[model samples]
Target: MTVAYVAVAVLLSIALVGSGIAKLTRADQVVTSLTGIGVPLGLFPFLATCEFAGAAGLLVGIWWPPLGIAAAIGVVLYFVGAVGAHLRKRDFGGLSAPVVLLLVSAAALVLRLLSR
Candidate 1:
């Protein structure tokens, strides 16, 4: 059971890292995409920073388990919101992927919580 939680944590970490990197490195692209969906361009950089910070926390946040958990929860919420944003824009290419990621991250957190 402990091993399962570890694996889930690793998976969620990777997902968070990937998403964070994408958002951080491609802020303009994200801004454009979100603009199409009616999201405010000014918020893109702030959101991107949050994503990056959350990912970093997941990767090296073992020193503060509660903080790590908070980061993971934020990522989960961000992904859930991403799915909603995509859906609102009729973007089929995005809806399922982030939802799956969100579920996996949340499941990982749950497993960790239970293992305690």
Candidate 2:
């Protein structure tokens, strides 16, 4: 159980950080997708920060279960919002990524709790 949680946490952390970096750099793809979804450009920094913080919490959570759980929850909510945005914009094409992230984050939350 612990091994599973660790694996998922590490993978999720990597993904979150990578996404955060893209947001911070304003990668063209990210910018295009976000802007198309009606997300303001100014909010990119805050969104990136949330991803960074969630990644950090997940990494530290390997040793501290509570933090990991909280981070997982935050990540889940973050993706939920992402999914919502896509749906709101009727951007079905861009929906898969956030949906995948949401499922994975939810998995991390359950795994962390069980591992604890």
Candidate 3:
């Protein structure tokens, strides 16, 4: 079960970390994608940085519970916002993937918390 949680965390970290880098580097592309979607381009890098930190926290937390728990929560919060944005865009197709990520992250968090 610990291993399962760790595995989920690792996968989530990969995705969230990559997304952060893209948002930081490709703000224009992100702005275009979120076109007329109300999210400011200026905010992309900030949010991306948080996501990246959360991802790194999750990784470091695996060996250190306190950080991992915090990161897990942070990532889950990030996903909740992601789910909201996707829904707001009426992009049901796009919503599914993020939903899965949210669920997996939530599950992993639960597992980690219980383990401690």
Candidate 4:
């Protein structure tokens, strides 16, 4: 169970850290996507920070379960908002990614809790 938890967390952290860096770097693709979604450009930095922090927390949580649990919870909430945003725009096409991430985060959270 611990190995499975670590594997999932590492995968999530890699994806999130990469995403956070892209947002911070203002990668053209990310900017374009955000614009299409009607997300405020100004919010990118803040969002990126949260992602980076969450990723860090997940990594750190390997040795400290509570932090990992908190990070997983945070990521779940963040993805929930992302899903809501896509829904508001009626972008069903954009729903899958967030929904998948939300599921992963939720699963990680549940695993973390059960570990305790």
C-alpha lDDT (0 to 100) for residue 67 of candidate 2: 99
Using all chains and alpha carbons, the TM-scores for the candidates as numbered come to 0.73, 0.98, 0.84, 0.93
lDDT of 1 by residue, 1-116 (tens): 45676677777777666666666666566556767777775676677677677666655544556766777788778888888888988987646777798788687667656655
Q: Over 4 Å off in model 2, which ranges? A: none
Query: How many pairs of residues in model 4 come into backbone collision?
Result: 0
lDDT string, candidate 4, 3-102, tens digits:
7788888999888989899988999978876777899889999999999988898888888999999999999999999999889888887788789989
| lDDT score for residue 87 of model 3 | 87
Better of 1 and 4 by lDDT: 4
Error of 4 at 70 (Å): 0.7
Candidate number with greatest lDDT:
2
Full-model lDDT for every candidate? 0.70, 0.95, 0.81, 0.87
Determine which window of 10 residues in candidate 3 has minimal summed lDDT: 29-38
Cα deviation at 36, candidate 4, in Å, is: 1.8
How many clashes would you count in candidate 3?
0
TM-score top scorer: 2
Ranking by lDDT: 2, 4, 3, 1
Residue pairs with backbone overlap in model 1: none
* Runs off by more than 4 Å, candidate 3: 27-29
User: Which model, 2 or 4, shows the larger TM-score?
Assistant: 2
Q: Candidate 3 has which clashing residue pairs, if any?
A: none
TM-score of 3: 0.84
